[model samples]
Target: MNRPTVVRTRDELRNVLAPARRAGRTIGLVPTMGALHDGHLSLLRAARQRCDVVVMSLFVNPMQFGPQEDFASYPRDEERDVALAGQVGVDVVYAPDAAHVYPPDFATFVEVGGGLTDVLCGDPGRRGPSHFRGVTTVVAKLFNAVEPDVAFFGQKDAQQAIVIQRMVRDLEFNIEIVVLPTVREPDGLAMSSRNAYLSPDDRVRARALNQALTKVLEVAKAGETSTERALAEARAVLAEAGIEPEYLEARDAENLTPVTRFGPRPVLVAVAARVGRARLIDNVVVDATPANEPMAASVDTTGGAPCVGRC
Candidate 1:
């Protein structure tokens, strides 16, 4: 088996892949913190299918985490991640250390500026203002370093993907931003690297994240249009499971903007909640047209079937 070549710094990565870049190859990038799983494999596979070469980034970004967040505890397994990426046909792995990516005097950042950052990730009350800013900044740096034709992101970070897409468009980056479906466990818990932090009981409680989002879809499919009503039902489901919800609402899939009056648009029912120390998130897209109404079959960009299961 041909193993994927691992590059540890931006200069090494550029040197190794210079020929491919010069040849105008279509490259795909899958960014993640170390600790690979089947969910990440799905993104790698999607990238493999779509591009001539694939680059997987394994950097646990510190800027995205708050002071009280688990940045220090976030898992990292480089050897395992490389082995798994090779097993799934990844061509190159870019695992850069913190100092290499961000020098001590690094002063620039890519901020989405205005309501975009505030709506989803920003804490307007000065709680976590730079959270999304850090995300966009690191992603912008990665895009510049790897220079991939396309980048794949898991939908478990739905708002993050939307934010990045907007950034790419606003900044005029010539890359396609592909959002993949959230891979889940058998019991409906969304798969995440942070899931490693969960105790056995916390793991069981984590399923409520998926269940609550599913409840929103159930209510929407049953002809419930009120966003308030749908969110109320989902909140009740989470409460029943003893989960404290961070946010649960239906919104336009493209913009991540809240939807007040729901009609036949493609809407996403998203949920975020804490299960022990780990924050779990999951979402389901609901096509609000009548049951008898036939629409075009839309496949998830992740190359999986659209999630249409019961709540």
Candidate 2:
């Protein structure tokens, strides 16, 4: 397998991509914080299929981690990550160091407001808006550095994807945001780099997060429209596993508004729980239309539109 050329600074990355741009080849970026897994590979595969050139950003962004969070202990295996990216046909791996990404003079941040940052993972009592602020800042920097035509993200980070799309739209970044389905384990657990923190027992218990969302999916497919009813099913599932979710709620899939009942708009059933040392999150989007099919967990939008309808 051909190994991806690794570049650690903005200038090197730009120089590496310059040829592709001059050749009129579409470039795709899969931004990551290292710890390559099937979830990350899924994004890479999608990028390889969609664009002529693929660039993966392998920075473990400290800005996105809270002081008390696992920033210090987060997994980092650059060698393994690069090998995997190579297997997936990634053309370049832009793994910048902290100092390179955030120098002494770094002061700006990108915050996506309008109520998107105050809920779910961004709940004031949780990671809050600061987490997203870090995310947006790094992503904006990546967009500027790579200048790719399209960016690929996984739906497992549904809230993050939504927030990034909003930022792209508000900032008028000329790039397409293509979100793919959440890749899950055989037990239905959503893939996350944080899964590495889970003890064996916690790993088993973590399935409750997905089980709860699956319950919501079941009820929604059965014509259950009441958000409370759907959430109740999810709660029962979590309770059976002796897991108390930090948050288990349903919302408007598009705007993240609180959804009282599932009507014309699709409903996003999201859940977050801390098992052992890992804090895990999972979600499923249910189409409320008569068809009652499960909607794609993400939206694909271009030209700064938050999304193209249910894209």
Give me the candidate number with maximum lDDT: 2
Native-referenced Cα lDDT, model 1: 0.75
Candidate-wise lDDT, in order: 0.75, 0.82
Best-fitting candidate, scored by TM-score: 2
| Per-residue alpha-carbon lDDT of candidate 1 for residues 144-243, written as tens digits (9 for 90 to 100) | 9998899888776766777788899999999998877777777877777778889999888787777777777667667787878888888888898898
Off by over 4 Å in 1: 125-127, 289-311
Clashing pairs in 1: none
Q: Model 2 over residues 1-311: C-alpha lDDT tens digits?
A: 69999998999998998988999999999998888778888788889989999999988888888888888888889999999999999999999889998999998988899888889988999888898888889899999999999998877777888889999999999999998777778788877788888889888888888878877777776778788988998899899888998999888877899998876887777888888888888787877676654543322211111110111
The C-alpha RMSD in Å for every predicted model, in order, reads 4.2, 4.5
The residue ranges of model 2 lying beyond 4 angstroms of the native Cα positions read 291-311
Candidate 1 to truth, TM: 0.90
Model 2 — TM-score against the truth? Answer: 0.93
- TM-scores of the candidates in the order shown: 0.90, 0.93
